[model samples]
Target: MTDRRVQKTKKAIREAYLSLILEKETPKITITEIAQRADIDRKTFYLHYDSIEDIIHEFGRQETEALILHLEQNDFFDDTADMAALFRALNALIEANLELYQHIARTPSYAFLWGQIKDILKVSLTETMGERLDIPRAQLEICAEFYASGTISTYLAWLRGDLPMSDDQLAEIVGDIAYYGLHKLISPPKAEGDEG
Candidate 1:
C-alpha cells in the first residue's frame, strides 16, 4: 500500500500537469513550472516522475485503466446491459472529468489515449460478437474500427465543447447511430419538386 502523503503528492502533480497543459502545450512546460504549480520542490517532482512526458503517459494509462474498471464494474458487455448503457457510462466518465479530458484532447502526446480506448472497444466487441460473426476477419476489424473511431471522435468533440448536446443526449445519439446505422440519419432523397 502506498502512503497517503505519496498519493496526495502524486495527485497534486497530476493536477498541476493537467492545469499547465490547458494553458500551453506539453512541450512548452518545464519541470520547474510543474513543481511550482504543484507546490512541490523539483526534487520531490523528480522523485515522483522523470519528466512531463512520463506524467502524460502515466495519466493516459490511468485514464484507460479507470475506463476498463468502470466497464468491468458495470458488467458492460453483459446481456442485461446494452450499447446505450455502455455509451452513457462512458459519457458519464468523460463529463465527470471534462477539464482533464479537454486538456488531453489538446495535448498531442496524449493522442494515443483515444486509440487505446478504441482498441479496447474493438476487443470487447470481438469477444462479445466474434463467435456470431460470419464475416471475414478483416471486415469485422473494419466494423469495430468504424464504431470505435466514431464514438471516440464524438466524445472528443463533446470534450472540446463543440457538441451542443448534453452527455445523455450525445449518448442516445451515439447509441442510435451504432444500433440503427445511417438509415434515420440520411434523409430520403427530396422529391424533384421539393424545395427547402
Candidate 2:
C-alpha cells in the first residue's frame, strides 16, 4: 500500500491538474502551474508525476479501474445481468464524477482518454458476452464494441447538453436501446390519411 503522505500528495496533484485542465487546453498547461496550484515545488511534482500528460493518463487509468470494479460489484457481467439496473448504476457512477466527465467531454484534447476508457469496456464486454453467447468471438466483439461505443458516446453527448435529458431518462433510453435496438425507439410511418 502507498504511504498516506504520498497518497495525499498525489491527490493534491490530481486535483490541481484537473482544475488547470478545466481552465485551458491540456497542451497549454505547464508543470510549473500544476506545482504552484498544488502548492508543491517542481521537485515534489516530479517525484509524483513526470508531466501533465502523466497526470491525465493516471486519471484515466484510475477511473477505468473504478468503472470496471463498480460494474463487477454490480454484477454487470453476470449471465443474468439486469440491463436497466446496470445502466442506472452506470449513470450514478457518471453523475458521481460529473465534473471529471464534463471536463473530458468538453475538452477535445481529452478525447483519447474517453476512447481509451471505451475500448477497455468494449474488451471486457466482449469477453464476458462472448462466453455467454454462442455466436463467434469476432461477431461478439463487434457487437460489444458497438454497444460500448454507442453508450459512452451518448452519455458524452448528454454531458455536453446535446441530449438535454436527466440521468434517469438517459439510463432508461440507453437500456432500451441495448435490449431492443433502434427499432424500439422509432415509430412506423403514418398512413397518408392518418390524422393527429
Candidate 3:
C-alpha cells in the first residue's frame, strides 16, 4: 500500500494538473505551473511524476481500473448479465465523474484518453465474451471493438449535448443496440404491393 502522505501529494498533483489543463492546452502547461498550483516544489513534483504527461497517463490508468472494477462488481461479465442494468451502471459511473469526462470531451487534445479507455474495455470484453459465448477469438475481438467503440461514442455524444436525451433514455437506447442489432431494433418498411 502507498503511504498516506504520498497518496495525498499525488492527489494534489493530479488535481492541480486537471485544473490547469481545463484552462489551456496540455502542451502549454508547465511543470513549474503545476508545482506552484499544487504548492509543491519542482523536486517534490519530480519525486511524484516525471512530467505533466505522466500525470495524465496515471489518471487514465486509475480511471480505467475503476471502470473495470465497477463492471466486475456489477456482474457485467456474468452469464446472466442484464444489458439494461449494465448500461445503467456504466452511465452512473460516467455521471459520477462528469467533470473529468467533460474535460476530455471539451479538449481535442485529450481525445486519446477516451480511445485508451475504450481499447482497454475492448480487450476485457473480448476475453470475457469469447469465453462465455464460445466464439472464435478473431470474431470476438471484432465484435468487442465494435460494441466498445459504439457505446463510448454514443456516451461522448450525450456528454456533448448533441444527443439531447435523458440519462435513462440514453442508457435504454444503448442497451437496446447492444442487446439487439439495428435491424432487429427497427422494423423494415413493407412493400407497396403487400396487403394486410
Candidate 4:
C-alpha cells in the first residue's frame, strides 16, 4: 500500500477499535469486525496491529506520553504549585477526549488503562514529594497507588455521570484530599487516658 493508504488504514482501524470498545467490552471485539467496520481487509488490519490489545496499548502509551509532556511543559508538577490548577488542567484534558476516556473507563481493559494512568500519577507524585520525603521507590509507589486509585475511581464515577460535581468543584475536592491527609478521615479514637 502507498504511504497515504497505510496511514488511512491505520486511522480507520483505530476509529473502528474505539467504536467497538464503546459498543462492547474489549474481549468481545474481534479483528474481523474491526476490519469490517473500517472497510478494510483483515489482512490490512494485521499489517497495522497484531491484535486489539496492541492497539489499545499503543493508544494508552501515546496518550500517557503526551499527557506527561504537557504536564511537564506547563510546570504542573512544580513544587509549591497550586494543585487546583493541575487538577483543572487534567480535567480539561479528559473533557477534550471525553469519548475515548469514557469508553476506556467502561471497557474490560479498564485495569490496563488504570495501571498506565497510575504510573503517570506516580511520576508526578515522585517529582512533587521525592526530595522532601526522601522516601524509597517502594514506599513512594504505595503512596502513589493509594492516591491514584482514589483519583481514578472518582474520575471514572464523574465520567459516568454518577458524580454531580463540576470540574472546578471536583478539582478542589481532590486537591484537598491529597493535601489534607487521610488520617483525619479514618482515624482511630483516642483512649480516655491518652494525652493531647
Please name the candidate that would achieve the greatest lDDT relative to the true structure. 2
True-structure RMSD for candidate 3: 2.5
Give the local distance difference test score of model 4. 0.78
Error of 4 at 148 (Å): 1.6
Candidate 1: residue 154 lDDT (0-100): 85
Residue-pair clashes per prediction, in order, are 0, 0, 0, 0
lDDT of 3 by residue, 1-196 (tens): 5699899999999999988887887888999999999999999999999878889889888877877787778777774255666567667777887877776877777778888878876876686677778777788889989988998888888888789988899888877877777866778888999876
lDDT of 2 by residue, 66-155 (tens): 777877787777743556665676677678778778778987888888888788768777877777789987899889899989988988
After superposition, the stretches of candidate 4 with alpha carbons farther than 4 Å from their true spots are 1-8, 135-139, 182-196
> What tens digits encode model 1's per-residue C-alpha lDDT throughout 1-196?
5688998999999989888887886788999999999999999998999877788778767766777778778886664236776687687667777877877876567778788777777776665555666988888888888888889888888777788878898888887787678885788899999999
Clashes of 2: 0
Q: How close is candidate 2 to the true structure, as a TM-score?
A: 0.88
Instruction: List TM-scores for all candidates, in order.
Output: 0.82, 0.88, 0.87, 0.78
Task: State which candidate, 1 or 4, has the greater TM-score.
Answer: 1
Candidate 4 local lDDT, 13-50, one digit each (tens): 98888888777767778999999999989998989998
| Alpha carbon deviation, residue 104, candidate 1 (Å) | 3.2
Model 2 misplaced regions, further than 4 Å: 187-196
What 10-residue stretch in candidate 3 is worst by lDDT?
Answer: 78-87
